[model samples]
Target: MSWGFWRNWSIGTRMACIAMLPVVLLFASFMGYSWYSHRIQVDEELAERGRVLARALAETSEYNVISGNLSDLRLTIRGLVQSDASIYRVDIVDSSGHGLASVVSETALAPQRLQYGAPIRKQVIWINLFSDNGTPHITAPSDIRPPTVTTTNVGEVRVTMSPTYLLGKQARRFRVELAIAALALAASGVLAFLLARSLAVPLQEAIHALRAIRGGNYKVKLPVSTGGEVGDLQASIGDMAIALNLSKQDLENKVAERTRDLLASRNEALRADADKRKLIQKVNSIVEDERKSIAIEIHDELNASLIAARLESQSIAALAGKLNAATPAPEIEEIRLKAQAITKLTLDLYASGRRLVRRLRPEVLEMLGLHGAVEEMLRHYDSGSGCSFTFHSEGDFSRLGHDLAISAYRIVQEALSNVMKHAHAAHAQVSLVLQDDVLRIAVADDGAGFDPVLSSEGIGIIGMRERVYALAGTMAVHSTPGAGTEVGIVLPLEDRVNVS
Candidate 1:
């Protein structure tokens, strides 16, 4: 009845209706067209038949008209009417508009009857006789030609034909056409219903599985092999369900492992006070390893997934841009805006994840060695921190082992973090110098310095000192209330270098 009603219909019903409606309409139109076309053709044929009958009557009545024999003319007309049932009436009129002979049928005229007229012309017969010398001479027969040079029109003959037979035949054909159309429509409906059912059954099953998944049942699956969009969707959903189930299991296992590790660590802490330094270092190493793992996970999985989502959103935006939307439907523009916003948000999320991973562990530290890594860090801070940092280095830190290089990098990083968090200064500098057997580095910030005697060292400063000590190095903190703070470290190069 309406589009809304159709929308409420089940998929099977809708599909059946959609499939059969066009077929039924086509069959009906074809039947009507066939009937109308046949009727037009039949009418044309009947008119032609009437015209031919009138012409023949006019030709046969020529002698009757010349002889003024009304009886014979009437008999000819009656004979013609008797010959063809459709010939309802015939009339012969002289040139003076006087009717000489007429014959009428007992049948009543049809609603739309055929009438035709033909003019009667006197026909001349020329007799050719052989002369005595075998030459030809022509003679005309009597008053029909009267030695005239051309034919003469004597009168007009009119014939009227009833179209009752044509109508009857057309009615019979229409009935046949109706019967055929009905049969075809019935067959098409049956076929459409079967096809729709075939599609809908599998599709309904897939839909049920989707609903189960929505209800948090990841075990639900559909093995429908329709080999179409539905099939692809089914496969994708099944894969997603399995993947989600695995992830859920993995997460639960991880939580249990972490709980056990926490209990073990608590016990170890209570049992070992003399090995506090070793425990602290071990904890630091564990934390660093976990950070690296987390960063890798974020980079590998989260970042990739976000980037993919962003690209998909961008593709959607591009497609939307290409669409013709001179006059969009309701909510179309809103949807377009939402798509663009989603793309933007996805991009933001990807950038943020990358920044997080970079902060957790600088990949450049592994790629370009310690010198390049420290320089890159300073450059990044100089650009982002609103404070100018000048870095100066002497000798190659790249020659150091990973542990030594990483310790140096961490000290510098901690010093910078202190500057950024506590320093109310605009200028900072970092120095890495290798002189003789010792490696020296200092990070100094021109800030409102705190009196080292009265101020307590922050965790960052303590951590840096511990790192320097763990490397068997000495660290110095120099600061005054008015002047800037300088954090410096010195390490012997013997233990850090490997000859091989």
Candidate 2:
């Protein structure tokens, strides 16, 4: 079996195998040795017994064979065969190798048998001491031998034995040995089970405790019931849980403190941002008020002065014309020319004052509302710049508050300014939609667009963004290197006036 397979086995099962395998091997070895030894011993005993019986039979049958008493020898062999169940057969034969008598046992059932044979012999003696008395002593040494002894074969006996009885006895003994070995193996298994259970219980408890710790329950109670690795492990786990609990508590406290600090910092940042926006809006309002005052001053005082000068110049020019017509003088003509130049200069100055008033504060905005103002602005840009401009508006802008309208106009003005300055665009589109209490403004251009990220710091964009932010609106600029730039703005018209 693979080590991985064994490793996956439960501790109890592994321990049981560890405890029982060697015992099983030992028992098997013992049984094999016993069987081999017993078989060898049984075979040897059977051969020796058969040989002894054959030899005794052959010796006794010599007399019977010489006397020609075959009938008695057959009776004796038959009786011997009947007396021993191990003796399968017995035979007696004469010295000429002819069987004189044979008895086969009908009761012996063993398939294996052993055969032994012995020869019957007759004794002979010779005494020759007077012969060769005249022979030389050296040559005829010991002419009178102690006595010649010889034996002649008279008959033979054969015995065949079966080992069934011996095998049956050996089988009985082996059964007893096997039974004892089995009992031993069973006892060992029981002991191993108990031992494994003892270890597994603690291990399972450790696993449970570790699982609890992993699940963030560090308050588990583990009793140290034993001394050794298991007890040490339990104690260590308990300590670790306590330490972790403390660490978690400390970390939570620190997190709570950090969270409070972060919240305060965030509130401070928001307040600062709100204050900055308020300042910007206040500055813009003040600047607009100053511009309006300057425009009114220029329109009321400067335009009147220019108009009076133009009228005086016109009267002088008319007088010079009459004098020249009556007298036909070159001096009067020169005087008429100077008067005409003066009148033209005064008229140009008056026109310049009017244009300045419009630039300082657009009187068209108050007269025509936001839509008309935006359309007027687009027309101005389209006429001045080489770029084409398109203007589109939806919904009535009359409901818009004064501040929101001004801010919207300024935002659009700044956007168009940026487009004209940097976009190098062929065409630009401006859309203003007042819908659902929200004003959505989009300014798109097919121009040499710039990276919004790099150009975000431009004064024009920053001013536009600040104005939108002051009015609580959101503005986004989407552009790529080659693609056109589009500025999308969403201003909530409902509460926008309150935002400033």
Candidate 3:
């Protein structure tokens, strides 16, 4: 059998087999030896019995043979054969080696037989009456004589005995022995089964306990009922279960503690992020207020001064023009040229001031809402830059709050500026979509884009991202070298704007 096949047997079965096989084999060997010895002994006894019977028959038949009464000898031999079943046949032979009488048992068939022979002998006695001196003395000489005996072979008797009866007896003895051996084997088997069961029960319990431990259930109970290896194994498994359970409890406690700490840390991070965004929003509001104040100062003060200066220069130039018209003099020409230069300088300065005011705060944002302001900015970029620009808007942007409108306009303005300055493109598209409380802005350009990772963050892009984050929005820039750049921004209008 394969190892797998044997291994599949239960421990009790294996142990029982281990305990019983040797005894069974031993008993078998003993029975075989006993049978062989008994058979040999029976054969030897049969042969010996045959020899003794043949010798007795030969001695008794000598007189009969001399008297030539073979009928009586045959009758004696037949009676011997009939009396003992073991003697299958008997025969008598004369000195000439002729069979004179024979008897065969009626029951003798194809029986295994042993043959024995004995010789009948005749004896003659002789006496030496004279000594070697050839003198006999009645009372004077010390001469002595000895008697001699001579024996002659007369006839032989043969006995043939069958071993069937002895063998049958041996078989009966062997049967008794076999029955005893069988009883012993059965008793041993029962004892072995009991012993195996005692061992197997504890082992099975240990296996169950181990299975429970493997399944992560460390709570198990096993009793040390017996001693030796099984008991020791049970004790060890119980100890291991206790240790594992303790470890599991400790690990669970540590995990719970760590989870609490992680939750607190995550909450702290969220709070810090929210505070940062609020701070950024407040700073942006302050900066916007300052820009408005500066725009008002320059528009009200600086522009007035430049206009007054330009009028005075124009008056001086007119006076110089009249003098040149009357006297064609070099001093009159120099005065007129200087007055014209002063007026031109003042106009240029006033125009620069106006442009600066517009950059600081666009009056168009308040007048036309977010949509019109973006459209106007796009128009300004399209007219000034060599790159073409397209504007697309959806939904009502006029419902946007003042702060949100200004932030959106600035974000668009910054995006367009970056497109014109960095993106060497032939076409650019700007899209504004407001729907479902969300305002999405997309600015895409077919330009020689740069890698976002390799390029440093510019002030304009940073400012745009900060504004988006401050308003609790998300911004993403998609760009690759040799490809186009697309900036997408999503702002939740409901969160940032007051519709009324």
Candidate 4:
């Protein structure tokens, strides 16, 4: 597995594996090197002792034997064995196959019986001291060297030192070293356990904390001072928790703010609608009252005046019927002038009254249609104001529904009225088009325009805005000071004529 992939493991397994791996590898290498060095030291000591015994026997015992006292051999060899407790045995043999003198009490010879000139095993470290036995067995210090040749002063002697005894001591020392190694290995296992526990415990706590947090316990906290990468992780999680809490709070606050704004806007719309309803009712009542009053005034007062002036003119013309055209008398001329003046004045007064009533509310808009009424009104405005006027239309005006026509008419009337009142305008243009179920109307004036922003105090402009709002249309008044104003309305052509 990749090293970094260990995190996917459970906390217990991960910590145990990671913490114990290096510790085990280190302890194994240490034990191996130590065992190797220890064995070398022990083996060197054994070889040194064996060599010393071989040299000592060659130098001391044989020289004495060269002086011709064979009995002295036993005494010197016996003294060498008494020097150390580690030596198990020492012995000497003759070339003629005689039993040798032994230093160890009740030590068995276990005779070596090798033929003359026979080769010895190398790893066995057998020295050739000849008791002249034909068989071979484990040799010792006395047997480590080549046998001496017979000479005149000394009879041929065979020395056999028991290396089996030295080997036994070596084995005992090796057993002690092995015991130390086992102890060391066991100690390493214990230390590794402690180290693994130190790492695993904190990690386990961290895992528990994570689980708790997952289960919705945000307050769960890991133990501090768990130094290293795990500690850093715990700290980062704590920071994330704090951030989550803050983000949640922020979201909640935003939702609350949006809700409050929505509620306030709804309340404002409700209030505007209530006020619009009341104003519409009041306007309807006023228009009904005005229509009644004007109908009565024209029928009674102005109609009587026109009938009287026409009669008076007709009476004078009849009375002067006999007068000649070429020699028309001064009385007839004066009477004709008086009668004509009265007739002209009566006609002008009648026309003026009609204009006043029509300005208030057009009867033509109710009769021939909104389109006819608008054209007539614009023609009147143009004739009176001495300003250029233009009207263009698209789509069938007859196909337009009542609500659409009325709204278009009201918007146009308001715009034109503004142009007449404040624009001091030289030119005005109005366009109405129906496209894609949307009614687009634009009224433009080349007037000495007022600032649109500063014009809100105007009831005339506010009335236009309110009317457009009531029609579910968007109105934009684009104007700059001393420049022209263009009022545009985009209304849905749904024809909701039930708006009354």
Can you give the TM-score per candidate against the true fold?
0.43, 0.80, 0.70, 0.48
Query: What is candidate 2's lDDT per residue for 98-184, written digit by digit as tens?
Result: 878888889887635457999988867885544467644342564544668899998788888888877788889989988988898
Model 3 misplacement above 4 A? 1-25, 42-110, 113-168, 182-200, 228-233, 296-323, 327-358, 362-402, 408-436, 441-466, 475-489, 495-500
Q: Report the lDDT tens digits of candidate 1 across residue range 417-439.
A: 88988887799999989778688
Candidate that would win on TM-score = 2
Q: Candidate 1 regions off by >4 Å?
A: 1-274, 322-327, 384-386, 498-500
Residue by residue across 90-158, what tens digits does model 4's lDDT show? 554444434345466235233222111211111223445445676655577665655445332222323
State how far residue 80 of model 3 sits from its true place (Å): 5.4
Tell me the deviation in Å of residue 188 in model 1: 99
**lDDT of candidate 3 over 238-258, digit per residue (tens):** 999999999999999999999
The positional error of residue 358 in candidate 2, measured at the CA in angstroms, is 3.4
TM value for model 4: 0.48
Q: What's the residue-level lDDT of 172 in candidate 3? A: 98
lDDT of 2 at 385: 87
Screening candidate 3 with a backbone cut-off below 3 angstroms (N, C-alpha, C), the clashing residue pairs are none
What Cα-based lDDT does every candidate model obtain? 0.80, 0.86, 0.89, 0.66
Question: How many residue pairs clash in model 4?
Answer: 16
Q: Which candidate do you rate higher for lDDT, 1 or 3?
A: 3
